[model samples]
Target: MRINMKPEEAKDILSDMRDQHLCFLESSENKDEWKKKYLKEAWACDSGAKALEKQIPCKPEEYVPDFPYNIFSTQKCAKCGTPVIGKKISKYCSECGQKIDWGEE
Candidate 1:
């Protein structure tokens, strides 16, 4: 059995597949291994050269800053200066527990 889809539907499906492929590549420990898999999948989808060209060849590790030891141990909230005895993740005022809105700075 076969099914027919509109051109727009096909495009959407292809786009979603490409995004998934990109995500897989991004998570791969070894990019060379992922490259082979990506190419094979792209060929199966009959993707254009442009799509293959857009494939990322390298995966970057995300950066995370060290936890603020001073703040966590001090029992004070990082954002609101509230006394946080055991709440290490607390960001609100100690007494009122009001959140201190620190907008992207």
Candidate 2:
């Protein structure tokens, strides 16, 4: 099953897991073997968190009128410029996974 989470929340979870593994590694009696395993996992978590931290905040650009009646409009992700052709919009860009804030519009 897929789980969705805010970038900050995911980062915090990964950072916490990395810390716990580091603590385990520090106190482990079998340093050689445990170090290899825990260190790899910790590194993975650290990188994942770092990647989330680096994502730029963005929103949907102003919708351009599509039909002559102006009932329909085409919107694009500000970061990725992936066009979204409809009135219904999502909180995140489907193409690039960039967070989108269509605030008060």
Candidate 3:
């Protein structure tokens, strides 16, 4: 089964489920059936998320991992202010064809 959701949204859902599980444990209720059900669902979601994170790439050479790590290193062009990703040592603006001083020399 596939769920349509962004990685961040999915991660948030997983976190909420984990908290619910913890709450169940603290309440000392009979959660055997619920545990059997939701635990498997949570595991499925978590595994699916991990698989997608590996499959979905984050540009030029970066493979972003979940939510927080999903952000890639980007630099703005000094001449055009266009954000460039996965390029830290660049000395030229790919957008406007202008020479960039990236302080690498």
Candidate 4:
């Protein structure tokens, strides 16, 4: 039988099933055997989800704003008092054609 479910829903269902199975195994006398078998299956499901997760490419770092920066250079324009410097600033100000000098102080 074919089951139609969204990826997220499928994952949630699988996780719930895994939790339920684990609880059942823990309560039963044959806990060790069930635990091993259930864990193996759960691991397989987790690996499958991981593989699927990798298939969906996330946005590139450059495309995302507010990305973390190690060395942040906060410099104001000597003439205009505009904050300019770092990876976000590719060129001189769009407002003024004046060159921005991030002095190394």
Better of 3 and 4 by TM-score: 4
- lDDT of all predictions: 0.50, 0.78, 0.55, 0.52
* lDDT, residue 90, candidate 4: 36
The whole-model C-alpha lDDT of candidate 2 against the native structure comes to 0.78
lDDT string, candidate 4, 10-43, tens digits: 6666667657766766765775777788778777
Per-residue lDDT for 7-30 in model 1, tens only?
A: 446656776776777667676585
lDDT of 3 by residue, 3-98 (tens): 687755665666677667555645556567876776666677666555444332232322334457546665665445666555655544566544
lDDT of 2 by residue, 1-105 (tens): 999888889989999999999998888476598899999999999999877864635657876655578565678888778876664457667787776666655
Estimated TM-score per prediction?
0.36, 0.51, 0.36, 0.41
Please give the lDDT score at residue 24 for candidate 4.
Answer: 66
Candidates sorted by lDDT, best first: 2, 3, 4, 1
Model 4, TM vs. native: 0.41
How displaced is residue 33 in candidate 3, in Å? 1.5
Candidate 1 lDDT score at position 16: 73
Candidate 3 residue 42 Cα shift, in angstroms, is 1.6
Instruction: Give the higher-lDDT candidate: 2 or 4.
Output: 2
